[model samples]
Target chain A: MTAPEPAYVAVDWGTSSFRLWLIGRDGDVLAERRSGEGMTTAARTGFAEVLESHLAAVSAPAGLPVLICGMAGAKQGWVEAGYLDTPAALADIPAAAVRIPGAAADIRILPGLAQRDAAAPDVMRGEETQLLGAAAQLGEGDHLVCMPGTHSKWVRLSGGKVAGFSTFMTGELFEAIARNTILSHAIAEAGPISGDNAAFRTAVTRMVANPALATSQLFSVRAGSLIAGLSPVDAKARLSGTLIGLEIAGALSLVAEGTPVALVVSGGLGTLYKDALAAAGISPAVIDADAAVRNGLAAGARALWSL
Target chain B: MTAPEPAYVAVDWGTSSFRLWLIGRDGDVLAERRSGEGMTTAARTGFAEVLESHLAAVSAPAGLPVLICGMAGAKQGWVEAGYLDTPAALADIPAAAVRIPGAAADIRILPGLAQRDAAAPDVMRGEETQLLGAAAQLGEGDHLVCMPGTHSKWVRLSGGKVAGFSTFMTGELFEAIARNTILSHAIAEAGPISGDNAAFRTAVTRMVANPALATSQLFSVRAGSLIAGLSPVDAKARLSGTLIGLEIAGALSLVAEGTPVALVVSGGLGTLYKDALAAAGISPAVIDADAAVRNGLAAGARALWSL
Candidate 1:
């Protein structure tokens, strides 16, 4: 009989949150766990302690190799894996396995991607690997993968490589503007991700028609709610729609108009994005981040063993 | 003896800075003084102390009437001049004025403009009066006035009335993204405001072409400087250009295209904006904000006396 196959663990460590999955040799997740002990908070409690505490809740072989993505490898995270500049492929990933001092397992951190385009000055991180993972699963094709989050990533994959990618601070801007700035009063505390509010959709469509008008249009959300009797929830939805739509309009410009783009959305706001994309006449292939992260980790783990 | 005309004082009291101008019967600034003392800082040192300190610096008539604008009239300012809802005209400005209990002179604080457009849902302040001031000077015509500052305002003036306006957090966003975020390394401590840099212009044009792509492009400023040898100053300029260009493109969409727009830029960045606008094929009429403020204050003072 084949010697007992070694199990593995996968982690997606983000800015304000953390997720872990214990997988069997066959890639089946045996256990899962998450926590608010993200990269920012983990810095306070030594990285090693946080990792151990989280791992203590999950079961895996003593020496099982673990794969991790997201901010876990950021400068302020458990171990800085540095960055792998863009126009990169799956093989370009830096797999400098992070050895946790006094920990129970073997761990390998994934390196984020960075790139500099002569046409414009910009770079990317974290999402490059996820795009690579998506590319690996899809095999070969030209598709647009949009990962919406605090800093949303709109990646272009061509022939199994990240040809180019762009990021939008849509989510971060939303949070900052809504909570920290003047628009806070107009937005609701909580609401459904999608609703049938014409005013909200109209505001979004207006922005799409003229993406640059976003900063000004944001005020309209509050004005509508206060002066035109728009409900706070609806106003919030309209604000969300306007921002996301502007981002989409911006991201769509990088690709050939009417290209066969498969928008692979991976984030908590996936549902909202899907609706917005639909409104824009684009049918997206929705990918639950849970599965994508696992797939990405498995691909990364496979690549490491093969190397 | 043409009793020494009791000139009115016009003040634009902002969050962290203050500008007070003693104006004569005509729209001429007799004396001007500025201070680091603003509403945000004044909160720490009581408003009365800050006001008195500024008042002491400029010795005007014994009981000159003062017309104030900006956060000085906010809820947290020295006195709260309740928000004036939209569709409000210059004549409709509230007279209640924020009552500073023990001030050296009688103060008549001008109310900020508020609006609730059906299309959008939010109100505005201070800038509305400036737009009114701009309209007051520029006369009746369709024009877009971009006032760049901590919170930049882009107002539309038509038929000598304040049609509507939109605000962009360009200055605040630039500050946050440059100093606080990952792109901090790209910015320099100081640089020439109107450097003739092609990279900066190119970045602005690219942003104009795809406004949504900024979030991702921001990282390149750092990467280009680190790997491709882009000077920090040039990188900073490019970053500024990208954000501002995106804003201009957005603002332009709100008005008729190719409709002979005049960008009346105010604040310190006016020179840089003038250069950028020139590069973008738009001729802007640069206004001396000091003069405009004096004119505005005089007009408000005259209006008060007429009332």
Candidate 2:
């Protein structure tokens, strides 16, 4: 347990975030680094340099084989890791990892999942790793996994195989609507929304009952403030609830009745989504998203490098 | 049929627009004026002076009575012409017009309609006047009138009485999502969306079939661009269709199956909505919103003054 010597590096490089962890041979973190130098920034300032700088910061061992996930593998990233099409096996991800060229140390970026159906052609870059990790705890079964973030991913897994998934612009839409639309005036001074807030619960119930009225319900936030004396906090809560609730309804509609749902999330978002799901009478098993991603990277490392 | 002298002025003063028509005793427009001096602008430059300038521009006679509608009657406008609660008669709207006090002329602003139910509190300002105007053509039956704009109002009218309504944040949301969200990248170079576009029609049909997946459908625009090589035009069309379709679905849900639907719209928005409704298996009666507002104002003027 004496920190087992640094064996490999695991990185989750997203759109606007970069996280790197130096993992020991025992599959435990020996050192870690996080920065805003994600794909967008690295693409401008050199992806290889960004990786090298972070590696140097943690005093990594020479020639450490790094396994990366998320946007870093996108077409616009360092090297396009490409996508492993649907009905894909979680076991196949490590094999599809595209290796970065001209690097002294070994570095491989994991492939994303893509649903190539014409009607609902979809793609996910990083969440597939989280899904792989969470699947370990989820075990083999018919499971509905909701990984909430900027682009919330709702995945359906059947017997350790990926069936299909839908990404809801829940978090991003909430920001755009609140800040860019007229709802800004209604929720200008509001603080964060919690699960127990009555407005949040009510909004969730309303969306769940009749999600077709989602946009109409959004306008009610403004009208409620203008005429019905709805408070700013309540207005924000209502907006959050409506978006989250709409997502829940959509995800629920795709899955069969009585199917077990699980929420893989981290930090404050975890509590908020837990409350939102609860509003829809769903109590999903919670999984730490941070740990899930780390565990996913570890699994990839073990599969690839035999660490 | 000799041209009658000007008797009164009818105005539709909205949030960011102002339109005035000097009407003759025979219900003809003697002189018309339009400006950007809506409530928002007039509140800064002076509502009375803006009215005086517009009236002077149109050579309105001295002491000419004026009937106004829209935001000019809001709490922060020229005067607070409070809302007439729902189940209100169109004929009674003129009686409820709050007269501007101490003016040389008899100036009045018509009251908006408010559905004061605690569950779904809603309000409509200027559209009530359009409803008043369109009511003449609508006659005596159940009608679902849709006035599409920044805040699209869907009215449930029965026997010339304002029953209830819902406002969908369709237009505003389209702009917000298109400009502020990641979908912006997908639709950056796209031109305006037309009704006949394949992507637009298909999106409308999808939403009408499954409104709960609205946000997910939104994300598909981006995914479609990335994976399916969807054009920028199609991306924009899909966004527009999803919102329009959602609105139609919500409006249809509130009324009976066979209730006649009408589109009270002006300019390019008319064709888009007509096409959207068609996608929902609805052929709404089209009413020119411009004429509707004028007729509504004239109706109010005739009721208020014995010209």
Candidate 3:
């Protein structure tokens, strides 16, 4: 396996995670690095030094221009890269990148997108870049994109521009509820739930049908375990299903009756959400999030420096 | 005020609270004692001893019979009183009460109600007594009773019998999400919100309108704080209104349309829930929970010993 000449560095720096990729001259990945030194950690450990250490570990050439995204551009990050309010153009995002001042090397962090509506104000940092990369594939069309995570982002993109988005605290709420509530005892002995679990699909269907019963349905987890002898795995699946189904229902409410939906996701949650969406009668166009982010960084790099 | 001759002791032993009232022969309260030594505390220190200490504090005479309700009858309580299955008469609750074995005095703990349906199983230990007390005031009707608390219970009482019920994790979820999610920062400096806050009412109305957007509405708490200049108090209010409204909507889904609704509540939450119900366009008949539980205990005691 022979390595190609590295062209630029791409980093997705989030709240508790950091991922870096050294792209080759031909846009092929030469090397990659991942760590827990995200903005939260990098803030205290020095962002520049953290970057340099990873860059050094990957053995990237000196002065390789780097493009970054995510919480690293948040207000509390190394440098505050302010938001580009909606409806923001994907093409214009590259130019809005804020450069690290006084650095010997070129380093630019992309701005997040903010929906400044009086009724539904929202913001997203890392996902805008993913949208940029995935947009080219979506072409000239209107689309509703669901990006599942701790704080899930659902974006409405039209003709290469973002109209607006809603962020649902789906994953965070799931962890908080499952760990902190009385349902914790119900879910304690449960193993990991799969996409094929009947309990998962049933919960999703129930929530989509009557989302008003959200909290009551949650209490049923405790009740079901206590009286009906519901096993723990099924209990956890029901919880995961209820939350994910509600997210899909909420995102679907924002779009039209027949809008095309896409799921931009990676890892295990990809399957979980896919099952949930299917349970909600949706078949989204799937996009690999890893490829999306790398391509987004690549697009930003090409615009800033034609390497 | 001259104290009357005590006949029996009525105790509401909840998860974290203990309230004992000494009832006179004329069905008047001779003395009352309140403490935090509920089931959680008493389980460690001993339930009989805790009762004795409280009884001694009130200077109750020896050989007085005690009627206990709530968690003290749970499986983990001092003695497992078991449950009286739904559709059972509320008047029959006292006869089902389990007397503690080998006790000097006649100590009987009331049974809770259990809805054992596969679709919506639920149980309540303490609130059943509240229902028994509140039931007489709501005589001869098919009614939807809303008892709001940590685990809010909504009961369908048809002709003085609990037909079915649902439990909503409203208060617990409110505390968990506020303290554990990203919205925690949004609500960090928030002062306690009131029932009359416009933001609270607005949120309740919005949730009742579109219950599907429950999690998204929660995110707005953070978004509003970040971009829309929402004050911390308003943020907290919005967070609260959303949960309470969802509970109301979920509870409403279970019963028939236009069923007469009643709110049996105690403490500060009484005002807050009344405001929420009003926001949801509900003018429920209000019943004081404190009075309801006492009356329920008195009814049970009268049935058991003919005092």
What would the TM-scores of all predictions be? Answer: 0.78, 0.98, 0.97
Total clashing pairs in model 2: 0
Model 3 agreement with the true structure over B9-30: per-residue lDDT tens digits: 9999999999999999999988
Candidate that beats the other on DockQ, 2 or 3, i.e. the better one: 2
Error of 1 at A185 (Å): 4.5
lDDT of 2 by residue, B171-255 (tens): 9999999999999999998988899998899989988888999999999999999989999999999999999999998888899
lDDT of 3 by residue, A1-307 (tens): 8768888999999999999999999998988999999888999999999999999999989998999999999989989899999999999999999999998889999999999987788999999999988988788789999999988999999888899999998999999999989999999978889989999999998888889998988999998998889899999998998998888888888899789999999999999988888888888899999999988989999999977
- Candidate scoring better on DockQ of 1 and 3: 3
**CA lDDT, every prediction?**
0.69, 0.92, 0.92
Q: Write the per-residue lDDT of candidate 1 for residues B1-307, one digit (tens) a residue.
A: 6634537777888877888886666555667788888888888888767656665677776677778877888767878776665554554553534545566676867667665556644455566556656656666667778777756677676665557667776776676667655566667574764536787687777767777666556656766775578887777887788777877777776788764555555555777777677666788766666556555666666766651
lDDT of 2 by residue, A1-307 (tens): 5547888999999999999999987887899999999999999999999999999999998898999999999989999999999988888888899998888888999999998877677899999999888889999989999999899999999998889999999999999999999899999989888989999999999989999999988998888898899999999999999999999999999999989999999999999999999889999999999999999998899998877
Across A1-307, the per-residue lDDT of candidate 1 in tens digits comes to 7643547777888888888887767777778888898888888977667766766777455667777787878776787776665676656673644555555566778877766667544455456556656665566767778888777777777776777777676776676666755557777475654635665566567766777767667656655655577677776787788878887887788888765555556555766777777777787776665676667777788777651
Off by more than 4 A, model 2? A1-3, B1-3
- For candidate 2, what is the DockQ-based docking class? high
- On a 0 to 100 scale, what is the lDDT of residue A32 in model 2? 91
How far does residue A21 in candidate 2 sit from its true spot (Å)? 1.1
- Candidate 2 has a DockQ of 0.84
Q: RMSD for each model, in Å, please?
A: 5.1, 1.3, 1.7
